[model samples]
Target: MYTSQQPAIAVDGQNRIHIVWSSYLPIGNALYNIFYRMRNSNGLWGPIETLSVFPNSYHNYNPRVAIDSEGNVHVVWEAYLANEYYPHIAHRVKTNRGWSEVVVLQSSYRRENPSCAVDKFNNLQVVVTTNEIGPSYDIVRFVRTPEGNWEGPDTVVHFNTGSRYFPEIVATPDGNLHLFRRDFGHYTNYCYRIYYKRYKILNYVILE
Candidate 1:
């Protein structure tokens, strides 16, 4: 019954709507995978496409989609690979030529809840919750340069005893970034808190 969960949507300059979500199929080689579907500018719906690779042994979840300035569709999700100790952040991009191969942005740590956004310069930025540094989960950022180079898995927020999750990021026309996420165990009186962070883009790079 987990056929659809955590859906993400984006629209390109041509007015085409792109959507991605995680699905669970008990009979498949992999129990969970990410699926994509789009609505054309003419309002016609296209066939649903499966976007995850290595589906034979991977369970994918928490997908996030973004559309760059040049119309490339970027998708990121969390996946549990076979025999792996923790989940990884996987990414894929669909351009004029079609979808590229699935790339793992982070595999060394326990990561989940990936979020992504494209700046005005066409650089892609992704964020996920990871516990690589410690037992407490931290919000980590990864930037894919406009020239197609990957930048980081830098930890942006940390706490000795708390965790962060469900990060969301947005890039504005002026090249500014806005990030928000849920915080847990940070305060004794409250169960959770919503945190906000702002960043600036310089030469297609995110500044601290």
Candidate 2:
């Protein structure tokens, strides 16, 4: 009845487990849908809830999620619109009320490999890579402020032509941000290496 992949998990302050994954073949369509399930603090597992609200047609892929201090679950993924030429970052959140509607964070850029982290103050950071029609070998980052406005489309890193990929980020209790990503020689016989970078917020700027 269902097939799934790209599972992502996070645990909130209450130790409740949240799981998000992508599945396909709901009714013979070749596209995929993102689903979520959760085990509450009381140890009860909820039913499978579909996250991708494409209603008619679309493909949501490569999901990643993180939990904030308030036990809010935030998820980011790439949704390939039915007739659009590129994919964009899709986001959703689950609070005490319920899951919010899937929001398209960016549709102009062809982004993928979405990852997210929440700071001590619950500022959400989402990092993604552009694989088409963007800078060569670059990673882009977006931060949602505490007041609920999205702050950036920052090109956090660049390695020149097909080397930047798989960016993952996390925020510490002290508000410092850490990122890890892989760089491969996109056009040569070279080594694929994983690297880390640290950034701190100082006077309204991210000092790397």
Candidate 3:
């Protein structure tokens, strides 16, 4: 039975499709752990793998997956770690042997609702919301370089310090990153407002 919801699928250059989602398994009196799954080339799905290993019971949701040119799988989601809530971004590369271990890309502050994509150079770019410090809101980006290392800390996209949620990232064919987010300020009377920004990878400028 499928326990996890919000499944996102992506295919790499070699026609390798990667599927990722968050699953909750009952432990005892209302306890569950978020798990992930994948389908290999032979059209057979591997066993369900647990993503979070927290002791205390916590909820994990909103999982998104993206694959790079080299068949590296990037997964991002909202997970409850310890006593805090934050967005977690992880990557697994397909090697000649098997799938590598999941590597965390971001693990600081209270980030939620993450989205990711890979640029033309096969670099992974992730976007998420953070509200750990104060009442302000911010969108952060994490890029995985070709050297198999994550680029420093998160780079802020917008510094509104307002309410931002439901972020979506997509790398355009022109090598530019397109980010879509919800701005609550514009829709004070309503629920939320949709905001779009195009970021140039080379220049690192957000365009209109």
Candidate 4:
């Protein structure tokens, strides 16, 4: 059997809903992979499709889904590949034609729990947690332009003695990006507290 976890959903302007999640299988070279499905405006659900490529003894989880202004579907997830010990954030986009190839964003540090959103101008924005520092993880953001150019893995939130993780991102129609995350061991002695930050977009630049 298989187990599913951390499902995310997004709706397009046409009212079609897309959903993605990670599925785990006990016996296979591919232990975990991302899967997706869609519900049409008529409320009929489409067949489930596998989103992660290669499988290849890698595990993927925490898939986040978003729909851009042009009706393209975007998914980002935490992937642990077969040949890599460190985790990476992987992204894929589906347009009217088909799904694009998987884009793996690997960094020197461990990254995971990606949250993604599409801005008013159709730029894809993503946020993930990085554990490069000693004590805890910090949240970082990445922006993918409509023309497929990528920018920024900038650290948006940091903690010296604790960890901030499991970030969630939202893009408003007014060109504002709102970020929410959970913190541990910082304010209340091992308790997780909710933290929020916002960014404004001007000419494709994210401003504090």
Q: Model 2 off-target regions past 4 Å?
A: 27-30, 55-57, 131-135, 186-189, 202-204
Clash list (residue pairs), candidate 2? none
**Global fold similarity of model 3 (TM-score):** 0.76
- Residue pairs with colliding backbones in model 1 are none
Q: Give TM-scores for every candidate, taking all chains together and pairing residue i with residue i.
A: 0.91, 0.88, 0.76, 0.92
Model 4 residue runs over 4 Å out of place are 26-28, 55-57, 133-135
Residue range 1-208, candidate 3, lDDT tens digits: 6465677888767665667666666543223354567776778877876655444336666777777666656666665544545645445555456665656554566677778887877786777777653466767776766677777445555544457777899997798888888877644555677888777777333344
> Per-residue lDDT of 12-109 in model 4, one digit per residue for the tens?
88898999988885335668888999999999999999888655538888999998878889999998878778789888999989999888887778
Which structure is stronger by lDDT: 2 or 4? 4
Give per-residue CA lDDT, model 1, range 1-208, as digits (tens): 5668889999998999999998886435677889999999999999999888664447889999999888889999998877675899888899889998888764677889888999877888888888887877888888887777888877777788878888889989888989999988847345878889898878645686
Candidate order, lDDT descending: 4, 1, 2, 3
Residue-pair clashes per candidate: 0, 0, 2, 0
What are the Cα lDDT values of the candidates?
A: 0.84, 0.78, 0.65, 0.86
Choose the strongest candidate by TM-score: 4
Q: Of 2 and 3, which scores higher on TM-score?
A: 2
